[model samples]
Target: MNLWGRINTLRNQIFLGFMFVMVLVLAAVGLFNYEQVSVLLRSNAEKHIQQTAVQATGKLDVLLRQIDTFTAQVATNANIQRLLMQEADGRPINFEERQLLQQEVRKHEAYTTGIRSIELYTTEYRRLLPLADDTLESRVPDEWISRVDEGKGRLIWLGLDPRYPDVVIAIRHVRLIDRSFSHAGYVMVQIDKSYFELMNAESAADNDRAAREYMGLVDESGQIISSDFPSDIEAAALISRQETISLDGKKYFAVQKQSDTTGWKIIILTPVDYATEGIAVLRTAIIVSVMVGGLLFLILTFILSVMITRPILNLIKAMRNARFGTLKPIPVTSATMEINELNHTYNQMVVSLNELIEVVYQKEIIQSRTELKALQAQINPHFLFNTLEAFYWALDEKGEEELSEIVVAMSGLFRYVISRADEDEWVTVGDELEHAERYLKIMDMRMLDRLSWRIEADDASRCVPIPKLLIQPLVENAILHGVEQRVGQGTVVLRAEPSGRKGYTRIVVTDDGPGMNEDKIRELYAAMESGQNDSAKGNGIGLANVERRLRLYYEAGTNGLNIRSEEAKGTTIAFEIPGEQGRD
Candidate 1:
């Protein structure tokens, strides 16, 4: 009421209208421009980073392929092959043969700058050849030797040599023909880790000197092979590949790519503030201009609103009194033509509204009485029972005992369903079981030998009170959707067990038919919990309605209905209700 009273005045209305329009225009124009500029800047930065990663990955791949080719040439050399063959015969490698093999290895070493050194070894013959000044390793690292043995003649990229962190080795296992291509030895080619460092240095030199972007290469095992970024910055990027992250209390934009050849991830982090410094300056200027323009416009609008609304202020005053009681005709005293016209229309509307009230009241009373009678007539049990009884006599007179029994059972079902119209809407457990049995009998006659059911109830649970029509629909759903859909016979079992909790009984309806999948079970349970009936997913009202009726009377924390199912297995539906167990 206080808010309405303040806004009802002409002065507050004019001030609010002008202020709203001025602020809305300023905010809309400033925010739209700012968003467009920011999106463009971020998109350009990401594209630049992705392109740089691709270029670096291509150069590294070319260098790796060249090294692989050189190792293959050394592995297939004639002198190396003859020595490996002679070593397989349990004979030692002669000094002259070793000299010829070293000459072949020297011939290949001069071909590429990427190769730092080369070594040859034989496990059975105990022969070693070294091409550099560094001493040959006492024994081949078992980790490297085992990997090469399993590589089946393919080159395996070893990221870093364990003994010498500065070296990266690409090794191949050599198999001699005399040994039936079995384990002879391995050929190791070592490349200085610094060989890849030059690539990063060249990339940095090619970019602008003022560029704030940092790039790095990381291998599959989370090792930084080459990077110009600080150690902490590189480690953080390797952990999470998000588009934006915080580093040293400042935000940065990050982009990453995985190399197809070497399986290494390339990451680039560019400081967001540095990249968009120009945008910040432009945004500040735009905000200042919008504020100035809004201030001038607000002043002019406020003056115009005051002049235009003075005459309507009197009309609003008269309308405010109309909320409490009947609206009488309003007097017109304004000099403006539109104000005089508005007062005349408002008076006519008041007179017509008074005349409409009595007629609408009379019609509503008639509608209420007629709807009540229609609902009562719809549930008349005598009408339904008489019709079923006539059908039963007709079937019996025609000597159709099976058909007569079904009609008799259906009559009992309708009688029980409608006879509780005046009762308290609760029935005993035995009463609900009788209704369910009648429904199952009708279904058994309809489905022939494909359906079977059993009901087991303890003597204590039979006398417990529950809502009417609780178990009938569940048994019906089990027969109709669960069993009838399959070719073979399906069985349904209804059991009432005493729950561990005091004053509660658990009832379960289980079926041995093809059951629902995970998605279907979830959809059914969701519909039940939300009290929505979705007809597309099998009889929405059947299970969901029963679940609601269970929850309406029972206590909370007890599931109204729970469904468990597996495809091609079966289904189980159960619920617990508040009831005493000792009564018989």
Candidate 2:
């Protein structure tokens, strides 16, 4: 339901593919938009921090100007000037004058907050006066005194007041009205640090807490003047010019501006995580949307793929069944038009193919019958051959025993050949041997002591059926071509036994006579291979026909004749037939 799982099936894979494409597109668009937004957000964050620093600096400028105005007012006060300028016979001022000067300084001190006190140092009188309650008289360092003396009338920041470290002092070398900017006495103003601290506190409070921001102020020497940040952060901010930097391996965004009044840098530090928090939220939203969309897409893709594939799968099943001779028309149920058309075409092909098969089968039957009748017509020579048998028996009745025996054998041979005229007829090896024996007898009388024959067949072989007259033609060939032309008596052997090849009987008709040369044997083999029955005198009854018929009956070339001959030696011709004894 959540879309994460194995995609092993076709529908699952298709669904996964759709989901994958969805994810890719969403990721591409999301990442691109996120990148752009992130850049804009980050840029805005930097500019915001910079503007915040500038605003803080503006606030600090106001406070610094107030301090400057306060210092200027005190230095120009008439009572304080007159008390410091009055010389009482080169001695310090009396208590009454001092009290009057203190009252004037108090007026200036009242205008500022957290001012510990105001004092006047008259080097000409060597007198220090403190102008407020809780104002202790302490020895001021000569460094501070000399700096104030060197300032002429310009105010000088004396760093932090040592006795009141929380306060900063500003001083101006006071000038008398003697037309001289000489070192008269110095007017010093003490301002509390809480003013600057308040400025920073207010600036940080204005920003959101999630921003994790803090501010710092650094002098021109990169020394911290006022801020709430840690020392390390302040140090890092002082040196860093980048809008963003890593603090202790964590990212931070920093921006700074220099105060026009104090020449101090105001820096704000915000965690990068805080700045890009919006981007993270946006990215999460985008991912969630993509997941939901992808799930919906996957469901839709699965449904569509199933709709498309189901009919095609059925068609495939039907086609597969067709391979095993199932030529039935496939049922048309495809939803798609093209697939339905394909199924229809397939159905037509099945019908046409079945029809063609039937037509071919019928034609083959007719051809077989025609061929059978043709062979029967050829065997119909039985009439003349049978008439010759009448003559043969008639001669036998005349009591010429040798002639009578020959005639009887000829009659039996003719009967055997005529009985087997039908091509479908099959005879056992023993019956075929008997037929060959009768033909040999006839040939023996014709050759007149020039031919002799023997038939050697195993009992098991004798029952094995073969095409009728399968051996007779080879026997006739042996006598006529092998013995009839020889000067002395030649022997013909008819052998039937279990062939060396399994499941077959080997029939060899060998003749010992003036053997043929290799050339004549080659010519006979060539004619047999070509299936051409050359009507040459040496090839009696055409050995090619006997070879072709043997091959056809057994349906194997190895079952056909093989002739082996040598000049002046002998010729051995052999063939094989099925070992089945029944007349199949």
lDDT of 2 by residue, 138-180 (tens): 4456776676666567777756676766777777777765536
**Which one is best on lDDT?**
1
Query: lDDT tens digits, residues 437-535, model 1?
Result: 988888888888888899999978988888788887777777766797677999999888888878888888888778999999888888878877644
RMSD of 1: 23.1
TM-score between candidate 2 and the true structure:
0.38
- For model 1, the stretches where C-alpha displacement exceeds 4 angstroms are 1-35, 123-127, 131-141, 176-183, 198-202, 206-208, 231-237, 246-250, 273-584
- Report lDDT (CA) for all predictions: 0.74, 0.72
Candidate 2, residue 467: how far the Cα is off, in Å: 99
Q: List the residue pairs that clash in candidate 1.
A: none
